[model samples]
Structures are given as C-alpha cells and as structure tokens.
Target: MSNIIAIDSDIDRLARKLEHEARLFAARSRNAEAPRSRSWIVVDLEFLFDRSRYEAYSIAEGKDAEEKIRWPFHQVAAVCWMKMEFVRGEPVPMIEGPFVLAAGEMNERAMVSALFATLENNPDAIVTTWGGEARDLAVLRRAAATLDLQLPHQLIDGSPYARERLDLCRATCVQADSVHLPEMAAAVSVPSKPSPSKKIGVLCEAGDWSAVRDQVLADVLTTSVLAVRHLAAHREIECHRADTMTAIADATLSAIPTSGFARKTFAPWARGEKAASQLRGVVYRAAA
Candidate 1:
C-alpha cells in the first residue's frame, strides 16, 4: 500500500508538469499570431501592513523575516492604474488616467473590488506591471478571496489573459528575481520612485493619506513610462515615438489639478527634463 501511494503521487506530479508545459506551448503559439494590443493598462498597488507583527511571527516560525507576507494581512492603501490608448496611426499614445482609490477615503474591500471591475470593464487592454505576476496579482488574488468577492474572468483560473500577462520584471529584467522597479526604470531612462519605500509605510502609519497617495502616483507613473519603453524595445513603436509619448505623459500629469503631492512626486522628473534641455542647447550652439 505504501509503494502504491508513492507511485500515485509521482504520477500526479508528472501529470501536472505536462499540463503546465502544454499550456505554455499553446500560449506561445497564440502570441506569435496575435497582433499587439493597442490599449494598455498600467497598474500599481501600495499596501499598508503591520511590519513589526509580521517580523515577530516570521522569526518565531524560523523563516526569513524579510520575506514579503504572502497572505492577505495587508490592507490596500492605494490602487492606481493609468490607461494608455494607442491609435493605429498616431505617433503618441493618449493617456486617460492615473485613476486612484485610497483606503482612508474608501473601504478596503471596495478598493479591491474596483480594481477587479476595472479589469472586467477593460477586457481588451493588456494589463502591464513591473512585478505584477508574482507580487501585485498574488496579493490581489488572496485579498479578493478574503473579501468574499468574485474575481474577474480575466484573472480567473484557466483564463488565457491571465497567462498572457505582461510582467515587465520578467520581460525586461535578465535577473527578474533580483532586479527592482527603480533599477529597471532607470535602465530605460524612465522616472523612478519619488521617495523611499520605507517612507510610504511611515506616512501611512501617521495617517498621511495624501502623502501615501503621492508615492503611489509616482510609482504608477514610473511603471507607465517603462511600459511604453518596452513597446519601443519590442519594435511596436519607434524610439522617437516613445519619447513623444513620454513627453505627452508628462504634460498630462502637469495639467492635472492636484495638491503639492503632484509637484513633489514629479520633482525628480523635472531634473531629468532640465538635463535634457541643457544637452539640446549644447548641441544646437555647437552647430551654430
């Protein structure tokens, strides 16, 4: 009986491996034939959790204290998504968002549900993220389950869209496990985090919801720029076109009527602009 059980377990493991491989092969074939998605949804989430408690629990369990909590113990502090629409013949994409939901202003379950609704409503847009596949999506899945909410079909089991997720960490990072969003964005000349991640949690703890919102907004903007750069790298758009789209993105942010949050969040990017202007001026003067 023991021998039979061992053999059955081995067979089940092998079957699962084969099924996963089969799905991968099918996904690859479909990707090769499908045209690139013109509509893109770039998303990022910020969570607030009790770090001290998590650390104490992990140490007691003899696990790495630094390991991110996999359970839905964290509250969704903010959820921000930027929608970019690419016209067939346009050089620069149009930006529709930076739509944000904050926990202080809304219930946690409602925030998570809003994200699911966004996915369901924009079924055709390709959802893009930095470490979304492993981090953001994992937390979202657990959060939805805990909240007793039904996930969108796009994120549901066996959904082809779920398999087709564009995780930039995997797509652009040679060392996906080690590379972070700031490093990846820097590599492509995109604006990075406005403030340290540690500060986000600190601000949340102090009930500085606006400050947390600023940090979340900054992250989403960085991710949005990175996504456009990825398209250029893949030859979906021209390099100059990517630059134009980025400038347009900057303009959109500037036009938004917000508090000092927007100004502070975008300051780092302003330095980049100044540097670029200096370089252009040098080239033009030298040519005169």
Candidate 2:
C-alpha cells in the first residue's frame, strides 16, 4: 500500500521557504522603476476528486440529513493541474492540458518536485493567482509540506492587492458594473465556452475536469488583462481597486452554497486574511 502521510507538515515547510523567496522578490521589485511591466508568471491549481462516490452518508434525509453529516464530507483523492502563462501586460495563455493525480496515490514529493521544477526554470517571475493568496498558494504550500519540497517562486495574490492598490471596492463595487473573471471571459467571447461552474465537483461530475482546469487558467488570463488595464489607466490606484474587486468576487462566490462539505473543507483558504496581511507586510518591508 502507498504510504499516507500528514500533508500539513509539508505545507508548513513549503510556506516558510516561499515566504523567504517572496520577501527577496519583493525587495527586487521595489528597486525597479515605477509602473513596472504588467507581465507576471502565474500558477493556477484545480483539485479533482469523486464527490458522489466518496461523500459520507447520513441516516437523516434532505436538509435535516445534511445537517447531521459533517462538513467536508468527502475526502480528496486526486487533483487535476496546469500552469499559467507569464508575460508583461498581456493575457497569458493557459497552458494546454492538465496533469492528473489519481486518488489515494498522489506522490506528494513528486508533485512538489514538478511544481518547483516549473518555478526554478522561470526565475524572477511574480506568481499571480485569483484567490491565490488564500487558496492556490496555501494549497501548494500545504502540498509542499506534505511532500517535503521547497517552493519555486515569489508569490502575489492579485485579487486582494488589486482591491487595495486600486480602491476598487469604494470606487467600483457594483456587481453589474465590473465584470467577474468568468464574466470577463464571456464578455471577450472566447471561441471556447467557459466551464459551467468554477467548482471542482461540478466540473468533475460533468466529465469536464480538464476543461474546467483550463477555464480557471483562462480566468487568470482575464485577471492579467484587468490588472494591466487598471495599471495603465490608473497607475496609482490599481492595487487598491484590484484588492476590492477580489474581495467582492470572493464574497459573491462564497455565498453560492453548492456543497456544504466542500465549503467547510476549504474554510482555511477562504479565511486567509492573516496570511494576506502577513504578505502585505512582507511586501512593504521588502519595498523599504
């Protein structure tokens, strides 16, 4: 049988290493000219697992039944993954295809090695993500801890930073006004249809896990577009606006109530203010 080790420990170690690298990167960025290139490297993560099959059953029925069941009822068995495009002030391409990790057999070490390999090859890159500050980055950090691997790049959670840097919430918080990542993709009217939902379970059920993963990457591309446009148009206000936009988006997504268990399972990622605050401090210090 494959060895089953606690993943949190690995995540702890990876977080430390990443924190170190992020500080270093922020320092370098501070010394660079203002209105820095919009180009950035991003890593997007999508986890896949069988929900209906693995979800725990309860004796009760309907809403009452669900109430009896524990939150995060399903255990994650595998993950579907991909890498994002890195460039300045342009929509980065979502790398084609995905790497699939089978349930109950993910080699944590191998996964971390692969992630680091990707990062090492792209030195001096600013890692970007939608909710990456809270979700994607933290998940990878945990995975690295589980695998005992060092992380590859400097991290930036574009969503929150964008809001804070650009004052988006106060200036542009209308739901109907600003387009969402998914909505932005639709507005652009990409030839391919956007995935049905961003939820991993929903995509897996539709047998479109790969497509969903790609959509997530595409969303990152949208983020890049918005990031650059905001920067170019309102160079002094982009970060605050982006952070507000991110906050708004997150609040909307969190209210969907698709899978109670999934909601609970991802609680930590959702509650990443602490980490985000810490990162912001690091950035400020690095800048100093």
Candidate 3:
C-alpha cells in the first residue's frame, strides 16, 4: 500500500466541521436566485527576463538621472497557468506554454484571454489567487488596458476574501502554514531552494532557471492543494504551534492580513458578492 503522509490531522478534523458550517452558510447565503455551486479558476503568472542585458543602461548620478529606467522593450518572457477546482476531484492545472513578448507587451489582454479560455469551459468559475486580487490581477488589468483586452470572469481574492468571510488566510499561508516555504517544498518532494530575487525577473534569472522553475511550480502546486483542502474541510491548519496540527491551523489563519491591499480588495468576495470591479482598488494612494 502507498504510504500517505497526513497533511494535518487536527486541521482535517476542523476542516470536516468547517465544511458543515460552510454548507450551512452556503444554504443560508443562497436566495432563490443564487446558484447552487460556485466554480473557481486559480491562476499564477511566471516570467523570465534577462537582467544582464538591461544592467548596461545605468546613468551617472544627477537629478536628471533616474535610478533604473524601464527598458525600451522588456525582452519579456511569460507564462500564465490556470486550474479549475470544484468542490470535488483531483486538481489538474492547465498551463499556457510560455511566450516571448515585448517588454512593452500589454499583459491585460493576455491575462483576459487566458481567463476567458478557462471561463469558456466553466462560465460560472470565479477567478482566484492568493494575492491576485491586489497584485497579479491588477497587473493583468493594467496590461489589458494597455493592450486592449476585456477581462473575463468575476474576481475573488483567496486571502482577504477568506479572512472576511471565513476568518482565514489565503492559500499561500495555508500551504506554508505548518511549515516554511522551504519545508513545504520538501514535504511535496520539490527540489529547489527559495530564491533571493525580490522581483520575478531576478527570481527567474537564467542561472537559477532550473531551481526557480521547480520552486515556483512546487509553490503553486502546494498552495493549490492547500486551498482544495481548506475548501473541502472548512478549517485551516495552524502550523506554528508545538502541536503540528494546531500550528498548521494557526499559520493558515494568521496569513490573512499579510497584505493590506489584498485585505481591502477581497473583502467583497469573501461575502460571496461580486466586486464592483473584478479588481479592487489599492489601499495606498500614490501620485503617479
């Protein structure tokens, strides 16, 4: 028999109870007009860029000189992946093959096209992500506006949305709740160390390609599985405590407010209501 590692027994039990609560919540939440089920599409974006070539554009110190100017063209390479997870079954991610686009390439259209393709298969699916509500989706929207693509699907941010509705963290913390990113990677048997790249470009450097790809995919898969577990069980694992299970649950719940923007943007989605804009406005206002 195959040995199955228990992700978390306590969280599992809590999840069962939570599922019961979720069902009741759903039942009460539904009016005569509400749909019987809510489908979801989770998305993650990966990009590879050559920073070596861009570093040559540095300017001498001066008021007129900018720190780092945007490249004339980004020499951008990107991949967008999606998966539809219902309340049941094994999750299979549908990934769009990586494409090379201009640094100036508008991403909004690409993101919308990718989402619409997923929606075409499941029209009722809500577009979701750990931080997509604040960051990823917003980036896509801006790119779409620049590229002229119409976004598809209603948006739901997993992190803040879950916190507001269920008092939980989004999938990232849930997946990493019981363990650190490195530990989670190990649990799933992913072979790559975390990168120091603060930006995707640096993260995706050619030197770190193999490890980065493995780590990124591992992170994505780990988070996806955690989200499914949360949905199915209704309770999160706290990973920080001495008791493995409680620690996992606590970690899962504690990850909710890590991002202020995510908290603000996803508040509506947690309540099972469509956000006025599939995207939520950023919490910090900056003069551009």
Candidate 4:
C-alpha cells in the first residue's frame, strides 16, 4: 500500500512535468481578464464505477480497478467546478460544471481536450479543491498522462497554482478526525452531498445517468460551500439537540391499507398495516 502511494506520487510529479510546456501555451491563449480579480477556483470530480465487466476509461479508474476484485471498475464520469472571486473586494461565487467528459459521452480525446481547453482560459486562476492535491488532481494528472494530454499551465506547479492549492479536505481532516466529506461539511453547516439515489452502477445500468450528474453538481457545490465557509472562519453550524434519539420503536401504530405481512388470522387490520409501513420505512433504506 505504501509503495503504491509512493508510485502514484511519482506519476503525478511526472505528469506535472510533462504538462509544463503545453500548460504555458494554453495559459497564454486563455482569457486573461479573470486574473485582474483575486480569483480562486474550487473543483470537484465524480468518477463513474463499473462492475469489472466493462473497460476502464480513466487512469484513476484503471488504478482503482487494479486494486479491487470483480468490484469497483471505475472511470471518469465527469468533473465539476465552482469559481469564487472577490468582485469589488466582496466575495462572489458561481458554479461552472457538471462537465461530462467520459469516453461514452463523446470521444475520449475530444472530451479531455475540451476540459484542458476550459482550464486554459483561466491562466492566473488559483486552484482549490476539497481533497484535490492528494486525490482529485493526482488522479486527473495521471489520467491526462495516460492519454498523453497536456494539462493547462495552472495545473502544473508554478507560482499561483501550488501555493494556492487550498485542499480543504486535507486541512480539515486532522481537525475533523478524518470523518468523510459530507459529515465535515454538515458539521460546519455547509450543505453536504444528497443521499445517493442508488449505487452508481445500478443507476448507470438502469439508464439513470441524470442522477449521477445531479449527484456531482450537489457534491461540487457542497465542497465549494464548505471551503468558502471555512475560509471565512464560520462557526460550527450544527445545532446539538437535547433529545437526540426518537422513540419510534414504541410509537403509536394505526391506519389501514395494503399490507405485505403474510398472516392468515389477522383481526386488527389497521394496526398491522401501520406497523408494516412504518417499520420498513424507518428500519430499512427507502426503496430505490
């Protein structure tokens, strides 16, 4: 495990170096106007997962697939971005994506090319992400390398990019005791990722791709919100309730409807129906 991490770090280093020349060209041709403001770019990525019966499209996917058995089988589904800048010295935030750049959506080369193109337009942009330095960026960097794609100059370490890579995930991890992204965000009152509708594979296979896109959008926004709130030194937003536990186990049971219970001798129909409905809803996960 340690060796793999070290090797991945080396890959990221090489990818950054390989992209150096192209990044410069891209930065020069991009819209330089944003540099006038103190702009920071907050980004998040959502990769699609397969069941190993499919092919890996992104380097991140391949790396993930290599470790897992017949599970995981990951691929780059999309990338999302949120831009925050000081306009007239007041903070303003805007969302930029749900950029679906996977191979199935379009030709893989063209999709990746467009992503880099978009990044090129923001030369002086300060890159920020939740856990980008260690995960997102490294994965993206590796993917670009695998494709022989040149990343934007800002992607390669230089003045603004490296110094300004504010990985809120890394910063908050030690403080938050390594709790996951959504938990950390919620504790600080930043809206977290919505409850996932279903497993990614199920949604993808069932042709519910829109759900995946929606999830990515929610995540990126949550990540951006968390970063902005933390930067502003916002207080912990979670309200600690005096009564934390609800006594649903001994609650009132009434009403009647269709019941899934298989009892031939049931006199009290209303009570049975209520128990069945409430019991399933509260105890088990809601039906997908």
Candidate 5:
C-alpha cells in the first residue's frame, strides 16, 4: 500500500497509463449520437481514487480540484448498475448489483468483465448516466487496460452520441446552479445520497456492503429519473410532431419535467396570456 503513494511509482504510472488507454478506447468509437427515441437505460457507478496520506495537507492548504486530481493512487473500490426500460414503460430502476469490485486490491479484470457484459447484454439501450463518460465507463476502459483484458466489443465502436451512452450531466442546463447529483435530486424532492465520499472508504474497509449498495442504487435511480425528465423536456421543446412528443412523454416521463422545461416553455406561455387593465382614457396630455 505504501508503494501506491510514492511519487512516480508503479501505481501512479499504471493509473495514468490506464487512463490514457481509456481515452484511446473512447477515440475509437464512431461519430454518432444517441437518438431521442424514448427508450434508454440509466446507469451509475462509485469508485475510489487518489487516496493518499497527502490528502490532509492538500485539503488544509485549500488545494483546488485540479491539484487534488493529480494525487497518487487510483483504484475502483465498488461498482453498481441500474437498468431502465423506457420502451417497456418501467418507471422505476432495476439495478442488478453493487458488488465489491476491490476485495483486497482492486479487481480490475473481474469488474470490467461484469460491467462490459451488462452493456453488451443490452445492445439496444441508450445508455444514460451522470458523469459516466469521464468517470465510470472511462474508468472501466482504464481498468481493462491495467488488467490487459480486451474491452467489450460494443464499447469500442460507438461514441457517446452513438446510441450507446448518454451522459445526463452534460445534457441538463441549469445556469442558476451547477447540477450535481444531489442538487438534481433535491430539485425533484427525491432523497439525497446517504454516505458521503469521505466515509465510503471507511465503510468499504469495514465490509458494509449494504450501505454501499444503497448509495449506488439511490444514485442510479436519481440519474434514471433525471435522464428521463431531461429527455422529455428536450422532446417537448424540440419536437414538432404530436405523436413523437406523446410517445416520448409516455416512455420517459411520469410528469412533465419542470426545472428547466417550465422556465423555457411555461414561462413563455404564461407571459403570453397575462391580463392587464386596458385603460381607455388617454390622459389628456397637459401641455408640459
């Protein structure tokens, strides 16, 4: 474990190498975007990275995000997946597993295998997630490289837009505030994540799998709901055809998304019909 924290050590080299590999894997995909067809899957994952004794000093000195990211050590601690069937009219998420990916050390090969298998099994899905491209899915590619395992066949072919993956974090527009997962859930009145980032490693060390499972599932559900809602809003605003809008509403939405949608559409509609007294008496302008 001490070796992991050493500067320019094997762990550091391997992590950065794997991350670079992940980037290469992404670059191999086709230039296509996910279609807004009211059918999709929402997924989320949680992992550990940049754990070092130096974190305390970094925090004490108020180090910025970029500085923090450069810390040595990277590992995938745990992973989870949630499947959404928009076409089938499933409103709730059906998350399969939040298994411990790192038993003693990070089980890079096995975790990647499971995640790849999940995506491959659902080839027809529009993979929706929050920060997945940069964090979760990308990390899998890196982990696969670290293990020298082949990436899933489907992953190497299509870009984020290729009906393969849809990252909701990049989709929703909230100029009023940045849309973090907790913030998005709060806007919808959904429950926030129970365990914080600092405590996750502690929990993992203590073998609290249930807590890990619950948090991952909560995040997945939140991502699923937000993804569906955001898609519906775009459809409502962008689509001209009534059939398409209705079909989308049926599949991706339970109620219309009001966060950005209302501000964009409803505000305009409300302004159009606002009543004011039509005073007829033009005040005889006293020659001033």
Candidate 6:
C-alpha cells in the first residue's frame, strides 16, 4: 500500500513538471489579458452500504480497517458536483450545477468514470471540497484501484494542480480533527446537509434515489455557499461579494421544484437570505 502511494506521488511530480513547462510556453506565446472567466468545481460524495452484508466481520475486519479505518467503503453511491464560474470584475461566480451521478442509475464504475472525465477535461479548473483530501478522494482512490480504473492525474498528490484544489476543511481546521461541513454551514449561516450522511446508505438500501439525490445536492450547495463565505471572512473577497454569491446560491436552491426534498431542506436558507437582504438594505441606506 505504501508503495502504491509512493508511485502515485512520483507520477504527480512528473505530471507537474511537464505541465509547468507547457504553462510557461503558453504564457510566452500569448500576452493577452487573463481569461475573462474561470471556474471551481465543488464535490461531495456519499457511500452505499448494507450492514447485514458486513455482519459477519466486525467493523475492524471487512474493509482494510487496519490501513483506512477512517473511510472503509465498498461502493460509492453518489457523486455530486457543482461548478461556480467567476467572471473577471464580477462580484461573485455564477453557479452552474450541483449535478448528481447516481450509482444506481448508471452503475458505480461508470459514474466514477464520468467524474474523472470532467476533471480531466478541465485541468485548469480548481477542485474544492470540505475534507476531500482525507475522505472523499481517499475513498475514490481505493475504489478506482479496486475497479481497475484510472483517475485524473490532477487529482493525484503533488500535481501542479495541487494549488488549484481547495480543501476547505484544511483551510479552517485548527487541530487534527476536521470541522464538519454542517457545523461550518451553521457558522456561516448557509443551508446545511438535510440529513446525516449515514442516511444515504439507508436510502440507497431502500432504492430511494430521489431523496438521496436531494440530500447530496443540498450538501454540495452548502459547501459552495460556505466557500464564498470563507473567502469573504478571510478577506479574499469583500463581504458584499460574498453576499452576492450567497444570493445566487439561494436562487439556485429555490429553482428546485417545491415538491422535491430540497425545497424543504433549504427552506431555512431561503428565509435567511430574504431577511439578510432586508438588513443589508438598511445598512446601505444608513451609510448613504
């Protein structure tokens, strides 16, 4: 296992070196203004499992518990991703998606392959996550290896794209343990996970894909809003810009059908955005 990790590290280094040369050549070839827009892909994944299948072996035995006790998994149930595009001079990025690739609909291998294809096609785009380096990506690596699949090199450690990826948990964590996504959402006053992730496994077992999709979608939206809020709080962008981002996210959530699980899941966020807008208006008038 250590050897595999070492090999992946070596591959990432080589890819980075080649990519750096390519970027230098491109920069010399074109002295144009920076591209008008760029994007970040925010991802969250949920696993599918059945406890009865693992009843024979204790939690410590069935799935490489010795090496990866943090996330021992047999399958990825869903892959949810969002693309936020930032136009130069714009206050906030436009939110494009919180698309779900359900394993039940397309099969696990195919779903993973689709995500890998998306990442490979967008080498320049940043990949954002709450704690992906430790959990989501780790689980994907193991799943890919078991399935004889290949992941995008940019996702590998030490790639030139290392700086292009944002692990929000790493950004905010002060200690060894990561701050949970829901807690961060609460801190930033954004919509949060509608249900515990363990509920995903339960839903999957019951073939409740719609509910699972809605839950994962809510999670990705929460992460996206939290990213903008984090940036503002850290002065990466102005607070007003963060407000714009939050408003767009709320709109995206509102567009979901009222009968769907997300409408109820994000009702609090919708109410909050309305109230916040009113308060911002008063503050602007007072300043004027």
Q: Lowest-lDDT window of 10 residues in candidate 1? A: 279-288
lDDT of 2 at 235: 45
**Which 10 consecutive residues of model 3 have the lowest summed lDDT?**
236-245
Which residue pairs collide, candidate 5? 32-161, 32-162, 33-161, 34-161
**114, model 4: CA deviation in Å?**
2.7
Q: Lowest summed-lDDT stretch of 10 residues in model 5?
A: 269-278
Instruction: Order candidates by TM-score, high to low.
Output: 6, 1, 4, 5, 3, 2
Candidate 5 lDDT at 166 equals 75
- Angstrom error at residue 275, model 6: 5.1
Better of 1 and 5 by TM-score: 1
lDDT of 3 by residue, 79-186 (tens): 333343332121322222212221234442453565555556665555544454444555555554556665453433334454222221344465555334345434
lDDT digits (tens) for residues 263-282 of candidate 6: 66455545556556666344
124-180, model 5: which lDDT tens digit per residue?
666677867656766666677777877655456547654566777766643443467
> Each prediction's TM-score against the native?
0.70, 0.42, 0.43, 0.54, 0.54, 0.70
Candidate 6 Cα errors over 4 Å, as ranges: 1-36, 50-72, 158-161, 235-247, 250-261, 265-271, 278-288
lDDT of 2: 0.43
lDDT of 4 by residue, 61-162 (tens): 765545442223334565556455544332233334324433346543565567677678866556777666655666566667778999887677733236
CA lDDT of each prediction against the hidden true structure: 0.70, 0.43, 0.41, 0.51, 0.53, 0.70
- Candidate 4, residue 192: Cα displacement in angstroms equals 2.3
Model 5 bad stretches (over 4 Å): 1-39, 50-72, 88-106, 157-162, 174-177, 236-288
C-alpha-based local distance difference test score of model 5: 0.53
lDDT of 6 at 260: 55
Per-prediction tally of clashes: 0, 33, 17, 1, 4, 0
The runs of at least 3 residues in candidate 1 whose Cα sits more than 4 Å from the true structure, single-residue gaps closed, are 1-37, 50-71, 157-163, 175-177, 238-243, 246-256, 259-288
